[model samples]
Target: MNAPHTPASVGATQRRRWWLAGAALLALAIDVASKSAAAAWLPGRPVELLGGLHLRLTRNPGAAFSIGTDFTPVFTIVAVAVIAGIVWYARNVTHRGWAAALGLIAGGAAGNLVDRLFRAPSVGHGHVVDFLYLDWWPTFNLADSFLICGVAVAVLLSMRNVPITAAPSTEGDAVHLADITGGRDGR
Candidate 1:
């Protein structure tokens, strides 16, 4: 049976939507702008600043640390799947934290995917623009930052046992939100 909506659930849904939209747009914008700036300013040679930080432009045709250098097309496909999965799962996001985390991941995926689709070489095989080298770490970009932060937030959320879906309703005769979304924890 379909359960009627309540004020609280409606508010939660609205909040989730706002959080997801805001986080995704902001992250995507920042990532794109940063990549553009890095490509333009840090092309010729590495620029050191803030003691140990270095800005170096690099084009990565692989995953993190330049792994899978021959699989740009595969990575492009994976990015699409990830973005779709996040959008599908976001309907059950009852917490702002989850929304923001998902948004960060989505934004990062899109940022990289854009490069893969339209940057150079060919469609689905373009290299990703990377910069922001620190010490001996691999050169990375804002997209990587967003992705890493999103994953860290996901781990923290899981460790806290916080429910990603709404809690059970107080009423006695209605189906629970948990039932509609998935299991009790919204996985």
Candidate 2:
């Protein structure tokens, strides 16, 4: 039988960490790239996708729907805190599912954080580039989509009772997801 703290277990944990980091990086890259493209081609104009779907490049100085328009610095601080929290949790990610979910959240947060730090107007007071405009929906970007989707996924996981906490060590007693979610055998 494999020991809890064996090198193999450690390797598995490392792999899990890589999964989270990789996913986050990929999401961030896509968000950044899409925003750049939108800025380049959609500025000052709107591109109709479907009937009500459109891309209208714009900069938002506040949170969703332009709330707190004068609190760019505050938003910047929140983003920093979020990124920090994600990093801290990432150190002990035990569930692959949570890794993916957290990755999306981290990536999305990082993307917007980047804009808040470097976009325009001033450092930590810059506006975020938004381009996606869906029927009657607030203008947003790839980062926003990722963030929303991530939250949805997280909620679903929680509903299913998937354990998101990490064990103190590979040798430590870990909670079995099957037990928490109730196994298919209904044991």
Candidate 3:
């Protein structure tokens, strides 16, 4: 059996993963903090910044663009499933960049999953607090930013990686004798 690849020879193969984790953590913290601030200082009040950029307090109990707010529990379950899949994928990724992307995706999904599980009247069905507003886009949070960034990273990495087929090997080039004989030797 072939031996597993070693980290020593790779020098810094594990490097980029930390960056992904850090980005995801910072994003989640910012998301939670901003939502808290909006809840405390801007509740029910809209703040319009220059060029009509706005900040408004809101709760999203749904999927992207508020599609499933009324079914918060279902959304929460799906979020959990997504996080689980990302975590498993990240754990086994060969490329550090790909792992980072997976980690960021997992963490970001988990951050909002946390809200859906704890931030309101019911566990596993709480609303995700959203306050950042844009004139052209649906209101969203830091978790969404991380999620989108991760997706972009993953797409870029996948596009960047092209699999190369191995050349036919001397050890694998031997032909079966049965093909030459056109029948089994016993037959």
Off by over 4 Å in 2: 1-4, 166-187
Output the better candidate (1/3) by lDDT: 1
Name every residue pair that clashes in candidate 3.
61-69, 62-69
What digit string (tens of lDDT, one per residue) describes model 1 on residues 1-187? 5346679777676778678778878998998999999888889988988978988899999875566889999999999999999888877776776777789988888888888998999999999999888887887888888988888777776666656665434543233435434466657
Ranking by lDDT: 1, 2, 3
Model 3 agreement with the true structure over 1-187: per-residue lDDT tens digits: 5235566423232343454466567766776777678889988789998786798878898875566668888888888898777655443343455555666677678778888888887899888887777899888877777788778876765564411111222334332433223353454
- By TM-score, rank the candidates, best first: 2, 1, 3
lDDT of each: 0.80, 0.80, 0.66
Give candidate 3 regions above 4 Å deviation: 1-3, 9-17, 162-187
Q: Stretches of candidate 1 above 4 Å error? A: 1-4, 167-187
The true-versus-predicted C-alpha distance at residue 32 of model 1, in Å, is: 0.3
Candidate 2 vs. true structure, TM-score: 0.84
| TM of each candidate vs. truth | 0.84, 0.84, 0.74
lDDT of 3 at 94: 38
Model 3 TM-score, all chains together: 0.74
